[model samples]
Target: MDTYTTTIAVASIVTSGITISIGVIGPALSEGRSVATALSSLAQQPDASTTITRTLFVGLAMIESLAIYCFVVSMILIFANPFWNHAIA
Candidate 1:
């Protein structure tokens, strides 16, 4: 490959790796903390288990969306990168 193509490939790979790594870390930590907090609240109020679980699931889904977005971005970078076209041209 030419220098331009090589550079683009390397950059895309590195950027995607970094994006996925950092993105997953944040959400993982957030989800862990959220679950811990919810568990503590549930322990304190067993009567509210249903409400707490529903809210926790919703919140977890929202938090997980961030990781999903990062995965999509990384997939685009590695597979359907626009720079590939530019490099080819």
Candidate 2:
């Protein structure tokens, strides 16, 4: 491939790696914090375990969506890269 195409591929790979790392790390930390807070709250209000569990699940799902989005982006970069065609053409 030409230099331009190589550059595009390299840049896309680097950017995708960084983006995936950032997306995963932020959500992982947030999930950890959420779980900690939820546990503490449950400890304080043992009777409200049901509500706390429900809210925790919701928060976890939201956090997991970020990771899923990052995975999608990474997969796109690896398999269905648009920049490859744009750069080569």
Candidate 3:
């Protein structure tokens, strides 16, 4: 209700929005590009399909983790925010 709470509330909302947008967009774009490249490579080399497929899965998982981390951080900021106590006082 006070300035402190107002500031924290606004900041948390903005941060969460930015975090989710960047987190989702970056991974989405990366995954799309990775898939495109992998498909192109597979089309060029049918014999290496198995190896390429395995590597693509691993890379996708790794890329996905980045987005997951961002989601976690944003959730923390929005739900379990450390600054909430200060703002409440």
Q: Please name the candidate that would achieve the greatest lDDT relative to the true structure.
A: 1
In model 1, what lDDT does residue 27 have? 99
What is the RMSD of candidate 1? 0.9
lDDT of 3 by residue, 2-60 (tens): 98898998899899999999899999999999999999999999999999999999999
TM-score leader: 1
- Tens digit of lDDT per residue, candidate 1, span 15-46? 99999999999999999999999999999999
TM-score of each: 0.97, 0.90, 0.92
TM-score between candidate 2 and the true structure: 0.90
Worst 10 residues of 1 by lDDT: 80-89
- Misplaced by over 4 Å in model 2 are none
Give the per-residue Cα lDDT of candidate 1 at 70: 100
Regions more than 4 Å wrong, model 1: none
Best of the two (2, 3) by TM-score: 3
Ranking of models by lDDT: 1, 3, 2
Backbone-clash count (model 2):
0
Task: Point out the worst 10-residue segment of candidate 3 by lDDT.
Answer: 1-10
* Candidate 2, 1-89: lDDT as tens digits: 58988888788789889989998999999999999999999999999999999999998998999999998998898778887877777
